[model samples]
Target chain A: MDGIIEKAISLRFEIAAVILFGIGFINLLLQSNLIKKIVAFNVMDSSVFLFLASQGYIEGRMAPIVTNGVTDAANYVNPIPAGLVLTGIVVSVSVSAFFLALVQRLYKHYHTVDFDEIMMLAKERVE
Target chain B: MKKDMWKRFSAWVNGTSEERGPLELPDTAVHHEKKKLFELSDEQKIRLFKAGYLAVAAVVCLAVVSVLLYTVFQLPLFGDPNNPAVNDVVERYVEKGLEETGAVNMVAGMIIDYRSFDNFVESSVLFLAVTSVMMLLLRDKNNISREEDIQEEHERIIEKEASDLILQKVVSMVLPCIMLFGVYVVLNGHISPGGGFSGGAVMGAGLILYASAFGTDKVRELFNMKTFKTVTSTALLCYAASKAYSFYTGANGLHTGIPLGTPGAIFSSGLILVLDICVGMVVACTMYGFYVLFARGEI
Candidate 1:
């Protein structure tokens, strides 16, 4: 018990990221509005990125740039994670844009963003 | 005989045999009359289900969060230089990134040179996203109605007539600086913290501001659908061809012959600067295209 608390105090960023992911997941599960669902999905993506970025940091290290010709590994935080985070950011933006466009089309067809309402309307249309 | 058997099989599957004749859609009048009887019960059932779902979701979310947090505790301490993540890969990147890629920014060098195809695909994804959005939302005669056309016309007129003077003035003053900064970032991406994606986003935002302030029509003169399609496709093609050549040569141990210019110079980093410009163009076009398509449903 004491060890868990100690680790929690030290790994605060990871804990916060986990909590944020949970919040986003709950919102995604509970929200019926498509737009709100998209926002929640974004929140989840951000949390994952936050976790990745936190894993890359080293205390007292500068960013992974070759300033003043310093080429030592100890002088910079891990660059791989930064590169990975960049990829994640671009993918997330693309996903959100695609989702928003899909939601817009759905709204145009059903005149509502409500998930349940759209389902009902779609059933009616098929019948 | 075979055709007769196939016809009968399909009829049986569809419940359209002689006995049933064909499936019939329920009568709307009867459906509405019956709906009233079940509506009250259905509504209650839905409410109950919603409540139960929320409770289940809450429990599941809590369980997930707790499990993840527990795992976090087992992980190494944050910000420790001795962590497993800071491995030989980091050593190679930081120590040799400049000599190999000639880019002062190690992250930029790693992504653009080492994993060139990944970055290429990222830019392609952005282009694909904007293209998909355009397909889904671009207003056309087939999907648009008469009333919607009139409404759009009215909105366009209002946009042109009452363009906010304050926004116009502010954007005019700031637009040049924003564009210049974006260009600077893209140009100096190899030598600085900023890179293609961020720089392109800045330029895209500037274009969005200009469009919103001055109206889409004014912006269209400079950047219409034709320009957008051309720029994105050209940039993507250039990125793909260059990256493919480098990858091919490197794999075969053939000389690429591309100069890794002096580190920290504007033109350093054999292909990173050129690739950065290509990516920046694609991203900038995609961003502006998204805004224009979403706002005006054209371009």
Candidate 2:
């Protein structure tokens, strides 16, 4: 129980990120507005980034910058997670832009932003 | 007269008029109100169903969060040196990265040299995303002349006094600086914290700001669909070719004997700087292309 408490105290941010992920997931699942769903998706993406980057953190270490003359491993945090998060951020932006474009097209076609209304219209068209 | 100009300038910069109007309800709310006339019972039933669904979703979300929190308790503490994430591989990258890649910025060196293949794929993904967006949105023009006329008229109005004079002036002054800083970030990635992705994003934002301040036609003359396509394709191709060469050389145990110049120098990191420029080009074009396509349905 003490170990669990210590873990909880140390990984508070990660726990918060997990909660954020859950909230985003629930929002994505429950929200019918396409824009809200997109926002929720972004929230989830950011939470995952936070979790990964936090994993790479070491106390008293600077960012992975080779400063002054120091080249020791202990002087710098892990660069891998930061680099991966950078790539993830770019991918998220592109995906969000593409999704928004699709949303725009859907609005043009059905004149609505609600997923339920769009699905209803689609169903009627199919029938 | 100058004060009036300043007032008009501030208003234009703020993108709002002096006359304030009452806030209007959103279209969805208005539509729902209209639908309440005949479908009252159905709306009530739907609301009740939605409430039930929300409660269930909330409970499920709580359960998931609890499970995740429990798992978090099993994971290593934040900033623990003995954590598996701070392993031998990361240690090597942190220690010998400057010597091997000749990049002062270890993160840049690691991404652009040690893990370059991933960066290459990420750049290609940006290019692919823009291509997909273009495929989805680029419409064939049947009434070309009519569309051109409309575009011309729009441009004329935008270029005329209707456009924000102060915005145009400030963007004109700031845009070159933004572009130069972006290039600096891309070129100096080896020695600094910024890299291709960030530099490209800044450049894209500058292009977007220029397009917004001036008319799209003016910005199009500077960077249109052809320019975007050419830049993105060339950059992606170069990145893939360079990474492939490096991979082949490493696999065959052949040292290409490329000079890794002194760290903190601009041209130090053999092909990293060149690849940085390529990635920057792809990212900038993708960003600007996305904006143009989304705004006008065609670029």
Per TM-score, the best of the predicted structures is: 1
Please give the TM-score that candidate 1 achieves against the real structure.
0.91
lDDT of 1 by residue, A1-127 (tens): 9977887887988888999999999999999999999999999999999999999999999999988888989899999989999999999999999999999889888999999999889988998
Real A-B contacts recovered, model 1: 0.96
* lDDT string, candidate 2, B85-133, tens digits: 7889998998898888888898899999999988988887777788888
- Give each model a TM-score: 0.91, 0.84
Clashing pairs in 2: none
Off by over 4 Å in 2: A1-6, B1-52, B142-161
Model 1 clash pairs are none
lDDT string, candidate 1, B121-155, tens digits = 89988988998898888998656777668988998
State the fnat of model 2: 0.88
Model 1 lDDT at residue B177: 99
Q: Report the Cα lDDT for residue A81, model 1.
A: 88
lDDT of 2 by residue, A15-70 (tens): 87998899799999899999999999999999999998899889988988888979
Query: Residue B263 lDDT in model 1?
Result: 94
| Model 1 chain B weakest lDDT span, ten residues long | B20-29
Best model number under DockQ? 1
Please report, as a residue range, the 10-residue window in candidate 2 chain B with the lowest summed lDDT: B17-26
